[model samples]
Target: MLSKHFRWNKSRVELLGMIILSLFKIQNVQIPKIAEGIISDAKQDSVIKRIYRFFKDQLIDAVEVAALVVDILSLDKYLLVIDRTNWEFGKQSIISSDFI
Candidate 1:
């Protein structure tokens, strides 16, 4: 389904799936924790690096992602709620959002 809209190569799509699964398994968005949850033959550090590169490269388009969600849910009409928050997680400044 993702391949139809995104230009990502097969491996990238697979990596995205892995990341999503890991997020569900661990219920955390932090890179290190996500990396820890990932099941891969690659080294943990390598997986972490790959995840960082995935975001750093900006491979995802938000508009396309929204469209994909709509299609998946087969929604004709729906309410969208988005909440944005800015805070500090340890020494790092974090901006987080929830969309429903």
Candidate 2:
């Protein structure tokens, strides 16, 4: 169901799989860590650079991806829930840029 967004190539699908696997495995999402998880015999530095380049070159449409997910689930009438909240860690400054 989520395969239509990718290009017609194995590398794109492979990268997507790598990203999904890394997301499930790691709690903290780090680019270098995800790159290292890719199943290739290449050097660590090379893999890291390739990952960085892939993200830098590709334009991932986040909104479209989200829409696709919602559409897929809507067919089955699955409940979709989203929760959002904003909280400050400490006292707010009077001259803070976040005020605007």
C-alpha RMSD by candidate, in order = 5.0, 6.0
Question: Over all chains combined, what TM-score does candidate 2 have?
Answer: 0.60
Q: For candidate 1, what is the lDDT?
A: 0.85
Best by lDDT: 1
TM-score of each: 0.74, 0.60
What is the clash count of model 1? Answer: 0
Q: Per-residue lDDT for 1-100 in model 1, tens only?
A: 8777677889888888889889999999999999999999999999999999988985688888988889889999989885655666897766544321
Candidate 2 lDDT over 1-100, as tens digits, reads 3456555267766777777777677644788888766778888788778778778887778676776777766765656564433445577543445533
- In TM-score terms, candidate 1 sits at 0.74
Best by TM-score: 1
Candidate 2: how large is its RMSD? Answer: 6.0
Candidate 1 wrong stretches, greater than 4 Å = 81-100
Q: Note the clash tally of each candidate.
A: 0, 0
Model 1: per-residue Cα lDDT at residue 48: 98
